[model samples]
Target chain A: MKVVEIRPPYLIFLGSESRATYAKTGAGLAQWRPELCSGQLRLAADTVDLGLPDLTLEQAAEAGVGSLVIGTAAVGGGIPEDWYPVLREALSRGIDVVAGAHKRLAEVPGLSESAAAGGAQLVDVRVPPAELPVGTGKKRRGKRLLMVGTDCAVGKKYSALCLERDMRAAGMKADFRASGQTGIMIAGCGIPMDAVVSDFLSGAAEILSPDNDDDHWDVIEGQGGLFHPGYSSVSTGLLIGSQPDAFVVCHEAGRERISGWDDFPLPSIEDVIARTVELGVLVNPAIHCVGVCVNTSSLAEDERKSYLAQLEKRLVLPCVDPLIDGAEAIVRGLR
Target chain B: MKVVEIRPPYLIFLGSESRATYAKTGAGLAQWRPELCSGQLRLAADTVDLGLPDLTLEQAAEAGVGSLVIGTAAVGGGIPEDWYPVLREALSRGIDVVAGAHKRLAEVPGLSESAAAGGAQLVDVRVPPAELPVGTGKKRRGKRLLMVGTDCAVGKKYSALCLERDMRAAGMKADFRASGQTGIMIAGCGIPMDAVVSDFLSGAAEILSPDNDDDHWDVIEGQGGLFHPGYSSVSTGLLIGSQPDAFVVCHEAGRERISGWDDFPLPSIEDVIARTVELGVLVNPAIHCVGVCVNTSSLAEDERKSYLAQLEKRLVLPCVDPLIDGAEAIVRGLR
Candidate 1:
């Protein structure tokens, strides 16, 4: 079952983030689910623009926005003090304030009281449900496709979202299963994998995507690289719990080292595919790689095509940039 | 650093447990650290005896017991309602009450008030420390050894404790680092691996056994088995965080299936050793297997020796029952 349920028709809040990279959450929501998002809220003049109409709390309320989502992440994933006033005002106006930040919105000094005063909910997507069962390792009755990565932030979420959209477009039954804060926000409901207690990591993953129809597909967003020294445990648990029948290897072009861990180089795509199969077999013996999703935004337009083509030839699998090329090729291979 | 600090001279509470196996926590403490234990307290007539003097609350108080440890585990690891009166009486007498049970001691009704009235601490070994850093995957100074297993409750903790004792006896600088509730209570301090948040599993493990002197050895007690379907994620995180220079494989003789997960067969010792080394090299490239530890309690005296001897020959490593053979053979191989 989904742990947190976030209301849509959101007003994206970009809290003084000048760089688009730092405002990924806001950008992602605006890009992927523009229909659910009503407008944007910026704290400063220099804040990154998500290309949506800017709206104040009064304007957002009048516009019938359901929730104000904090889209910008601070350096340490914390909620800034200046944003608290805006959040309090949003809650005081009877609009729920949703945050994927490290600090819980309900725990902020005056936010909960304001929310109570307006009869609005304070939703913290980062907080997991109180009760989570230990994973039984029993296979569920549905097809699953998990996005495995060679490094953190290598487009696992983007790949999973793209696959879900493309699969549905192709007349297939598919749902996007989010495992991180931003993905959970976009998906409207999901469990925060890393926030769960260690013993229940796999159990939480199992609950995230329960048994479904035989032909249905749950495109699970993966966390951390399997070869990642620090976060591999999270990845491993998600993999085993997901018990995916198929997986897509996600990687970023022009990246040679793991982000924030310079001492360790990123594992090869072949290594990730092999290791994922090795571990994934513990739960799903029929696990296999179906495609490769690479973020080729760093490469030139001409170079991107050739790069994917070469990779497809070498790996003997469909390769594409989920954002630029869409996951139609990958969806075609699922049949 | 250790998360919980339990005091010495413990009074073990067996709490209506008729089976010695269910009273493993009390039995472990009584067997491993008899010097620190004052006596055992049983609530029922047929409670399994640990051979220590049966002490009443009044007798334990007069005997100067530092803490009363609830040693027996109920069916679901929950504290039975019948245990409240005995726990309250112990706390009312100024004796600190320590428990490694799933339920927190302070949350029990009236227990905290009783502890406050008598100025006694209610220690819960299952709770992790508030602050823990994410694992950096940077190599730390000092040598380390970790005990891994093929399934849960297969003598990983016992083997680590045995190795620590034998290593010290052989004039080696060694410390036993606990990672579970029972191990934490036994060692007076440790991080409960399964209790930590999923994101910080490796981080908590990193803090549990920090850097020591160059010659010092941190013998860390392992958690779940690497091949365990439900628990392998915890094992993976701990393995990465511990980054053991040497490891010992733990298994139980006469058991061919995973406990509670009979559908899955127990992985062979060789499979465990190979997998441990494969994953362990991420943090420490020099990681290698030092020996094998088998729980041979179910085997006859003649069968036990032959079992270990054949294992030693096949695996080409020292094989012993930490309880029966004292782990001296494994300690010798460490050097």
Candidate 2:
């Protein structure tokens, strides 16, 4: 007779058979009504205990069990110390054990070898690798982009989103990318697609790369935050791949913290601009221009102009507001 | 006569030199001195009343005061509202007002235009900018580098230091191009260079990339908290400039709010790898391999190896311990 198995933690306790399994195995302990299992149970004569028989596994073993089916329920894909002895005994008796899901278990010590030794094979829960998408032969060209900030929560994404929007609006292809912390978590599988890739494939976006044949410009990938470790790694990877053409940065001091940021050596407008420009030179030799967007809530327009003049004097490129001027300054500076 | 300026919170009462001017020209008080400002007596040719000064320009013409300097002791750039009228009257006379470091008087509405119209120049305490050694043109190709973190404290600098050590150990030319946060802050002028950059420049350590010849790698850029918006922006900026060949991503658990992270859907290891890989792809098309460095306080070698293998298979990359396998796996995967 055929046997159907369910992993533990879903309905029954892990490491043991269900009360329904006891009756199906013909164990003389107690009989289960078909109604108990919604009539989905299959009565099998040769169900066997494959591990340390918890009370339920023991009853099934005593009832002359033959085969064991395993799914993700067993140890959440981790190895449990109690499952070994029963596995060994069952293999010795010529019973087959089938397992699926729980890829991590493939690395559990001696488990794969033991199963293989017993002539059993493990199956993965992922769509057979064949179902995954293949690579498109593409390369990123020279659409240099940069994301920067003065402090945390100071419109970094606003700048990036603006850049993406303005670039597309200006008829230049562009995409926003995530770096730092979000990159790390997402990199591991927190979402359907990593945030960086998501931006690239978004409806209104066009990736900033060489392969997509467009004229005025291709893609202008914008970054999310500053100095995030995960983003740093992801961005480094992108630079190695895409190689953008210009660097755009955002600086803000709407709060009193601007001057008080004296703890940082480059605390003033002059200092921040200088260092960012230098870094830009080191990374993208192709950086044609640099754009700085400043937050102006704390100061008046004249002061803002003065501050802009001061910063502009220091920066090799023009500095402007994204909300006010859009991509015009960036495009002009590059030109 | 030279006048000594004191900081804010001091009361001012008008004196005899201003009573006639106030009656004749309807001009308000002229000069202000802190109550205890007897120390400035020697510097003044005559004494004037200190109070809320009537600020008609004709009063100054009639009083023959020539020029008057109203001192508001605002410190730390905090400008109070009451000072604007006094500042405006003085500006109308083409008087030069020395604003306290804290008072952002220029930020007041109409004050910017007032200062310009009144020919009144606003001055604040300032020190001359310092000069530092710049990068040379003959250093190395692709030597100019920039490094960024995935998130704060995720070991961007530590990794850079290790990479520097390894490069030196292998006899490859390398230098710590930038000091990460310190460098960024210094360039921004948030702090004193004497305390930060000057010390480093004065030390025996070589600084590069001011000119063209110093091909150097920058170490670490970007910023943010543990999750959400860490280094995404800064990393993108760095990538736009430097385009490093590979990336090493360090990962940790997502925010605790994510339920069942250790299991399926929520915090599965697979999600992390996928997200990171997504960002890695944008950074460098050549980046197919992401070295997953699991952060555990301590684990036996066998356990570590087992975990690495599981993550690799799950994430589809060659995972390894930086302390053990070094960059070997990353290099091989990239190749």
Top lDDT prediction, candidate number = 1
* Interface Cα RMSD in Å, per prediction: 0.7, 16.5
Q: Which stretches of candidate 1 lie over 4 Å from their true place?
A: A15-19, A41-49, A53-65, A80-94, A113-119, B15-21, B41-49, B53-65, B80-94, B114-119
Worst 10 residues of 1 chain A by lDDT: A100-109
Candidate 1 per-residue lDDT, tens place, B117-235, comes to 98899998888988888888988889999999999999999899999999999999999999998998888889999989888988888888788899999999999988777899999
- What is the C-alpha DockQ of each candidate? 0.78, 0.02
The per-prediction CA RMSD against the true structure, in angstroms, equals: 2.8, 32.4
Per-model TM values vs. the true structure: 0.92, 0.27
After aligning candidate 2 to the native by TM-score, how far in Å is the CA of B304 from where it should be? 35
Native contact fraction per model:
0.76, 0.02
Candidate 1's C-alpha lDDT? 0.91
